[model samples]
Target: MKERTIFQKFIHTLVDILVLLSLAWFIVYSFFSLYRVSGHSMEPALSTGDTVLIDELSYRFIKPKRMDIVLFQRADKSYNMKRIVGLPGETVIIQNGRIYINGELLETTKISPIALPGLAKNPVELGKDEYFLIGDNTDSSEDSRFQNIGNVHFAQIRGRVWFRLLPLRKMKLIV
Candidate 1:
């Protein structure tokens, strides 16, 4: 029968709580983040009511590239999930169901769903730290094709989409 001091028990409890909270904060801020899918603008790839975890650390070492799924905050303060179609300082043009970046036809096979409808203007130039993103479901999506979401500033991006963690069987890495 050993006796424990009240001060010691309080310290132990406080330490336990702090440890758990620290771990949670690290997990949420660094490696993974939880986001609620807001609209069907990204349907087929993602839908409403889906909770996803974006990997915030990957881009820390490696810069994001074309065709990588990403999560970013819009001008309206809402987060949108989409795939990157053009990189910084590159030209992006969508014409006749084809995408041209830097005057070269971008391979459509790299995109998640084949057959991307190109925009009327081909070879739109990108500014420094600017990237062009688009939703897989282009027809219903307001993406780079439109003036509003056409260019995503590098500062607005939160991180790359790592995986979908909800809806059971549908859960998997975005690829």
Candidate 2:
């Protein structure tokens, strides 16, 4: 066994503090992370393998709005990147490949090249803490229009997409 000198003891304490601080920082930063797209759910706007920076802090100040791209947890334990189509307390209807909110057409430019395959027959009304989401690739995406992923509660949302940071030529803020 070796006895530590006073100087060595001081250095050990300093190292311990530094390590703790670094760990805390890493944990906080990971919560606001850059997630990479793996599927074609958000094509035209976000292609496969595109990395997006998620701003987890924005929801802290304001609620997510319609057409805002969001990141949420899926039932299968994977993260889903989708666009908000209906907010809390709103009625959403998808008919004839068009989206209608509160019986009026939605105004947004996030749709993919393909037209949606029509939505569920009934209108979906979001609850106080629920949000309706859908992918840009409406024709193929299984989102809020589907029975499995209809309305996402606030707690399941991670954050809004800030911007894309890969494939330089296509890099741009999430519009």
Candidate 3:
């Protein structure tokens, strides 16, 4: 009888552990995802081969803000990361290698003057759901300035990149 009681307690503990693990997995699967940075576009912030953790749930509760680093799906269905420069209902233009929004200079330390302004050479208007994105590496990034990538719609954005998880030495919050 003593042996049977011990075995039963062991089984109960095992079941509790399994349940806890399943709950943890479900939370992670529903609220987060991982992405790898593949190009120099977002350099100095996110580098090639850097792994990032994406928070998929926050956007549902809050609107994306300017300067947020986001993971979005391109029209080709490939994923890319970029920083938000212009928000909805804004006019964005690139002149003299600098960015202008609503006829005013958009200043941020993250971006430098870009050599190739792409479609933004002319004033580009953003729709209610559209956002202008650029990479930290202005010269190399293929972003909203170009015709191919264009403005990113809210639906195309997968999640906000909040943390860097890989390359243990470099691990830190991406904010």
Predicted structure with the largest TM-score when compared to the true one: 3
> In candidate 3, residue 100 scores what lDDT?
92
10-39 per-residue lDDT for model 1 (tens digits): 889999999999998988776888887877
Task: Report the Cα RMSD per candidate.
Answer: 4.9, 6.9, 3.3
Predicted structure 2: lDDT: 0.82
Q: Candidate 1, clashing residue pairs? A: 93-123, 94-118, 94-119, 144-150
lDDT of each residue in 1-175, candidate 3, tens digit only? 9999999999999999999999988987789998888999998999999999899999999999989999999999999999999999999999998889999998888886799989999999999999999998998899998888999999999999999988789999988
Pick by TM-score: 1 or 2, better one? 2
Q: Which of 2 and 3 is ahead in TM-score?
A: 3
Q: Can you tell me which runs of candidate 2 are displaced by over 4 Å?
A: 1-31, 112-119
Candidate 2 worst ten-residue window by lDDT: 112-121
Best by lDDT: 3
Candidate 1, run of 10 with poorest lDDT: 111-120
Q: In angstroms, what RMSD does candidate 2 have relative to the true structure?
A: 6.9
